[model samples]
Target chain A: MESDQYYLMRTLKVDLGERSYPIFIGQGLLDQGLMAPYIKGKQVLIVTNETIAPLYLERLISSLPNSLTVDHVVLPDGEQYKNIDQINTIFDALLEKRHNRTTTLVALGGGVIGDMTGFAAACYQRGVDFIQVPTTLLSQVDSSVGGKTGVNHPKGKNMIGAFHQPQCVVIDTDVLNTLAERELSAGMAEVIKYGLIYDEAFLCYLEDHIDGLMGLQPDLLEQAIYRSCEVKAEVVAQDEREAGIRAWLNLGHTFGHAIEAEQGYGAWLHGEAVGAGTMMAADLSCRLGWISESDVKRVESILAAANLPIYPPEQMTSVQFKEHMAVDKKVLDGSIRLVLLKEIGKATVTADFPVELFEQTLSAGDKLGKFI
Target chain B: MESDQYYLMRTLKVDLGERSYPIFIGQGLLDQGLMAPYIKGKQVLIVTNETIAPLYLERLISSLPNSLTVDHVVLPDGEQYKNIDQINTIFDALLEKRHNRTTTLVALGGGVIGDMTGFAAACYQRGVDFIQVPTTLLSQVDSSVGGKTGVNHPKGKNMIGAFHQPQCVVIDTDVLNTLAERELSAGMAEVIKYGLIYDEAFLCYLEDHIDGLMGLQPDLLEQAIYRSCEVKAEVVAQDEREAGIRAWLNLGHTFGHAIEAEQGYGAWLHGEAVGAGTMMAADLSCRLGWISESDVKRVESILAAANLPIYPPEQMTSVQFKEHMAVDKKVLDGSIRLVLLKEIGKATVTADFPVELFEQTLSAGDKLGKFI
Candidate 1:
């Protein structure tokens, strides 16, 4: 059984020259003795939140080398708590424990825990090595694979952050079995995004496997995650700093961020925001003649099947959308540059889209269910 | 005329591949139309402190392209204020004004302001372009050269920071004419450090031209700043993250940081602490038989001539020194690594030095004046 577990392990590389690292995918990876080599020092500081700590913290501790000294900082679980205040807690634990530059921080939770832990590692002692043990499907498929580490700002989501990559990413599909159904659906949104932006067949596969993914089938989930990681890895390797093609990764993020920011961060899971936001993007793309109306219906149907939101929140208005998006990092000079789909598996980052079409989509986005 | 300032400009390059940037040193770079090309967008946020805004901020503003929209966030002036609180003030200004990723933040002040601004830029929008308009001798010669940007933590100096390089460094030496004599002396400590670590010839130049530098002779001051930047640039280019040889730059900083942390930041100017700390490092080096006692004395004399401190504070005990040094970023695992001089112009980073010798130096460090 042990040998079979090890045999199931697959690795994907994110080629960032000297800073490149690997993402390991499998079941039972947390128990397979995989974390020791990546941890270079004698000291380890695992940062997880209250919810995740009770689930996998003990299991993670048992897997580490016995001789290594270990400590943990348990943060409050939620997106609202992901801020500079929480980061200070990690810094306090490290300094109080006298953990030095050689210390390795393990981010062992979902996107919130991983982001805060990765950021803490990035800032602690001017940067220490860290490994990602993503527990949520959202983090495994999206946040954990990218080097984008940051905390949310009141005005925007992920407004304050850094581009510090982890030493390695350890993705164990078994952890997703315990994830909340809402969280599981949220993760599928990003998984579907990879296919929408880069791989058409992958999108079709996700459409077919939505039920299997929702049930947390190990093989189906692992394949989906592996494919999603491959897509992000290719984009990040080409533009480590998000100078050009990397901006494509922000496909639904412009609308998603506005939703998360306006409704308060934790009220809506990041993926729920992205799911609805992607539908809005598709609608805008169709209006621009890049994607057809039928294509938009197909995108909406897939997201609906995954039980993800396919429309903007009722309270959100066109003015509010524009107001929130104006503060986005994607806004260059005074113009908001958006990532819109050209067709299935194709996207373009542009500021040339018509304002009338965008305004029309914003006014009509929440009513897309009637057309579907 | 005005052309002389442009003609006299000296540009030094920090070659870190794609992150490489130039440092321009001259008399009136602010007024010489040097910063416009580097400003990527119409929005420019100039982060200056209270002490510097009245003096050079106006000149910098006038020099910027008129079409550019520029705003200023002047923080309180002091090392004590160089924390997350002040960094938040920059973030507040940027978010309130809706400054996006394309915005360029110009850090115009002493080392404290430059460090905070660079850090703010590093965190704002996950990293934005920042230009260093270093006005202090300490900043122009040292802090502004490498990509080292951060605020100080109460437990340790520079405990919280990121290795975010500036887009360009603009050093206007003319501003130093208004700098206090005390500040000038603080700047010399770093200037003397370059000679101690990398170039014996430069040490001789500083020793011979001490009067010209003290008097703020534009050419002499500019030459010293240029050479110091060159040495720092070379070291940083090879080790941008301070994983190895770059630690040599901390020759005086380890001891200096302990002093600053114990006394509280801003109580002792960073260079003053560094000056006294260098004497301690020299004493420890002599105890290790790495440098002769006379060489230690020579190092002290140069610092004394620059009107800088040559002894650790009297209030600090050897135990207190150890306590603070224990929390330093350089304390790898449990071992305290010190950068020791091999000779007047050579240094090495090692943990092999005798603890008894280090203790002896710490106990007798403040009493070195009697020996000299």
Candidate 2:
């Protein structure tokens, strides 16, 4: 049965013209030889975190062809460790090993690992090839597919980074078997985001399968990941640089980044913050009369079903959100532009929204879905 | 008379399609309102070093349209200060001042400041618009025109960086008056390189006008800078990513980088090392029967006339050169590729040359131009 699941593997391409690459989704992709073709050089450096090294490092290494020389650098896990110092460690390893410009970096962990490795490849010798082997649900569904690679700043999230795409993304659904329940919930938030922003049918599907996905039902999980990546790939292809429609991907990210920044990164897993931030966006959408209060409740219920947060942390104030959001990459000319839903599956990035209502949303706290 | 010199301004475009930008060369371009059109935003962060801030920062500020908000960060000068910490200082200033995505960073110094600032602009907020206002002669003719921006690592020169083009480059020849003589000589090395690598006519032009250029005579200086930039702009336009002909621009860079890395960055200015490295390359080319011994002497003579070094530093050994060259960005699959001359005005990037001749050239030292 497990072998049959391998035969059911799916592949998608991110059409970035010359920079285009494929994303492979399946069970046990690590051992399936999917990675061999995308690697452009004879040398490989696998960048993973300490938490993930013991789990799959050897499996990933043994899967590569014997002709290639491979090395690994295990970074400390967590968002706080994502900084320039850690990036230097990757550089140090590459230099110490004498990895040349043709070396390919394989990111072998979750989003943090993918981000740091992709960024290191982006700037290593002023750019090299990198492959994404995203092990966690959050990374597989969102971060891995897009070329958004960066580390966090003490004051902001992803403040320093580059738009460097990976040569290919290897997503093995079986890796989710080891993911913590909280992380599983976190990944669901982005999965749900695709539904909210681009597909009402996907949202409906998630609503129907939320429980099975939470329980790690492989088929349900694969469907959710495949659809989410499809939406992400479509959006990224249309607006790779985020000059237009790509901003839609940040549906709740502006508010979510503020929450993550306020409480400190890693205090709230990115998706949890997005879970609540999406509710806040939906609430504001309700206020704008673009969506009904019931629609806001629907967003709350879907997120709640996924075991994600539906409200900002009680300790965070509107002033803190304002402070953090002002520094967001999305902000332009000092005005904090946000992605708000015009309908259940439609969104717009706008700064034309009323200031008073935004201020009210910031202070709304637990009463987000109530139209009072 | 000064106003007439301003009318002699030359404008060239780096034709990179969407990433295309212009290079403006002349005397006192800062005061001519050449910068206003290139700045994409209302906020400007002028990043200059202490040395340049005193000389041209205020003048640069006064030249900007008063409607724009301008800020400045003065970093300590020299190549040693070019690293991640200094890049953070630029980030700190931008975030502290609340500069948004629309803010444009202005790099207003020589290679070190321009490199760090352009890199900061490349990574800050995951990339932003920047304008290059190169002050030193070397930068105006070379670094400022190309989109190659980075800072050196302890293990290597420019080990970490990005390929980020600027909105435009504003070169003011008058700034060279305050430039130290050694720095002017260093700039001449690259000027001579334009002659050696791409144009025999330009090489002969430098041969004839070497004294006037060294003395910083305005007309000769302008012509040298113009022709040098024209070659650089042409090469960069053909190979923006350095995957092809762009590597030809590194004529002396492999051996030069080895010298720079061994002596520690800033011990020998980059062009000084290149001056000697180019001599070594010419020697090896002679050994390859690609060029005659007299041709190597011409290289030595032109470099000597510019007050640049024609030999590697005394303490550097062949082994150290081998060690450092092994880590060069040009090295592919562990083989150190060098840009060697085919003739007086042509160069090729190759790892196919004889190893013995390369070793002999490394140990040649003061005997670089002598045939045996």
Candidate 3:
């Protein structure tokens, strides 16, 4: 075991003061026995989806100490299935199994699994402890790091939720080998977002190595995920409850969430909606003279090269977008505040932007899909 | 107005450092226009029960600034209605009214209304501000002061909740004038608990003034409410999350919750269960030699004078008590940790008590209801 191997398995902290925890990212990190210290009690409930349970659940359980009592609840996969019904199922299992407050809930899947499981942990016994075992590229970079845990309501995305941080986040990069290629690219959208929101240099690196990242070149993927987590962790540390700069992370999410809610949650992958939504935000920012038109093109090029959407579903009209975003959780008072890029690296949450430009951005896109 | 009149309307602070807020206990605090400053937004959603809305809702609304947009949701009154479904109803109203993150939720009833409304505010847009306007004696003394907010699941009482502090708590002493006799007695149970858990002198005061409190003498009742809030505020200030000394607050809750869950919530008022539950705990303490049998008798005498139950329901046997309590949220790992009195003024949370002694205590109680 060399020092570089240990360096490759990097530990990043989401510094939320007393509630802070570390994120362990690298290949075969689960098998390296990293999860045991975070497991505070005798009982561990591994909450995973049906899709990932067979592939990685056993490997996770095998890594834990043999003396630990473990049970699992396999939820049906996909974002469409993430709802209060599934949460009820998790609660029912905990009660039936008699898992007490001391039980640690381990979420093993993608963002849906992590969000729902985190919420279940937050609500159970007024809250118990939970650990995130993110398996998807998107979750590894975004959802698994922030303390935002929730399920979408029919009226809006993440309408019912809580800000419950996890005990630790374990990112096993090896698991990405099993993810579908389309899902892989969808995740790159969030990866690209980290650069778009805060790191111009990282954006340049993505542009330079887009091909390698798309191909799942381990080194490139690791760098992208690590840098993305670092950016997210920094923003979250400043504003754990989104009182200020933290909302910058939702650069494309306001428009993206509207698309997901209108199309139904699963029709478009979260990152796909985000990719198209990011393009809209860029166009709006360009119209506002916050960024040059070329910068918008550069964003489109990166997302396009990564095989992501640059437009929402053609069926959604600007009226629908406005209505959906109106009820968005981020809407303070009655105005929908948006995160708009001032340049490649800087983003701002503001309500000062023109409404017509937003409408133009929403109306500008046509139906199209790309694959890496 | 005399100094005594001013004393009747005392404002006590729950010192939680930055999250600290005042608990206003007085006859006409609501009409004094105290709630306006605490309400942060133009919109206020007053969540009250059908039973309470007609009694005091209009008075509350009239006290708010006329420029503010005010709405009320009248839920059917009962502990049974405090669940996720009701939470959804609150959500629906918020959405339908297009209440944004800036909207404030006002809980305008007793514990059930306060807990459910506070939870609604907590889950709405991740969280919104809420104020506690406790109308019952129980709420004025206990639940309204603490930030513990959640709906109940069929499996347990308050099984699904969060620790969301309210902006402020307004206790209109006059509202107790409309409370039913049983409800007032139930509130007295909590009032007595304050003395039992942390203040022996307060317990002695309670013993001396049981007649005045039960008779609803204005000065005596105001004094009791003020002191109970003080004890609760101190406990919560030290341990807001029930990590240690705060567990003492659950002195009767573990056993009380089981009774509420088994009998079905609302079949017995929460304080009614606590009344009997506290006696059971006191008896257990007596058997353990932590407190004398005479001390236990004194506890019984105080509760009896306040018109509360001192034993479990006739239908509930020791086995049922064991089974229901096994699933209590406070059961860490597999052990049921109980908050027991070392003496009337001192309480400790421990799993060290003998199991058979607990069972014997459960079986020792007779089915008798007491009235002042």
lDDT tens digits, residue span A1-372, model 1: 246543588999889888889999998887676878889999999999999899889989988888899999999999999999999889889888889888999999999998988888888877998999999999998899778999987777787888889989999999887889899989989998999999999998988888988888889988999999999999888888888888888888899988888898889999999999899889889989998888999998899989999898987888888888898888987888899999999988999988998888888864555322
Writing each residue's lDDT as its tens digit, candidate 2 over A1-372 gives: 235543668899999999999998887787777889888889999999988999999989988999999999999999889998999999999999989888999999989999999999999988999999998899999999879999988877888899999999999999999998899999999999999998999999998988899988888888889999999999999999889889999988999999999888899999999998898899898898999978888998899998898989887788888988988988888788999999999889999999999988998953543432
Q: Candidate 2 lDDT, tens digit per residue, B1-372?
A: 235543668888889999999888887677777889888789999999989888888888988998999999999999999998999999889888888778899999999888888999898878999999999998988889888899888888999999999999988888899999999999999999999999999999889988888887888888888899989989988888888899999999999998898888889999999999898999899999999989988998899998998889877778989988888888888788999999989999899988989888877773444433
Give the TM-scores of the predictions, in the order they appear: 0.97, 0.97, 0.95
User: For residues B1-372, could you state the per-residue lDDT of candidate 1 as single tens digits?
Assistant: 255443578999889999999999988777787878888888999999889899988988988888988999988999889888898888889999888888899999988888889888888888999999888899999889888889877666788988888989988888998999999999999999999988999999999999889999999988999999999999988888788889999989999988888888888999999999999898888888888988988898899999998988887888989999988888887889999899999889999987888888888864545432
> Which candidate has the highest lDDT of all?
2
Q: Which candidate has the highest TM-score of all?
A: 2
After superposition, the stretches of candidate 3 with alpha carbons farther than 4 Å from their true spots are: A1-7, A366-372, B1-8, B366-372
Supply the DockQ value of model 1: 0.81
Alpha-carbon local distance difference test for all models: 0.88, 0.89, 0.87
For residue B42, give model 1's deviation from the true position in Å: 1.3
Steric overlap count per candidate = 0, 0, 0
Can you rank all candidates by TM-score, best first?
2, 1, 3
Span of ten consecutive residues with least summed lDDT in model 2 chain B: B363-372
Global fold similarity of model 1 (TM-score): 0.97
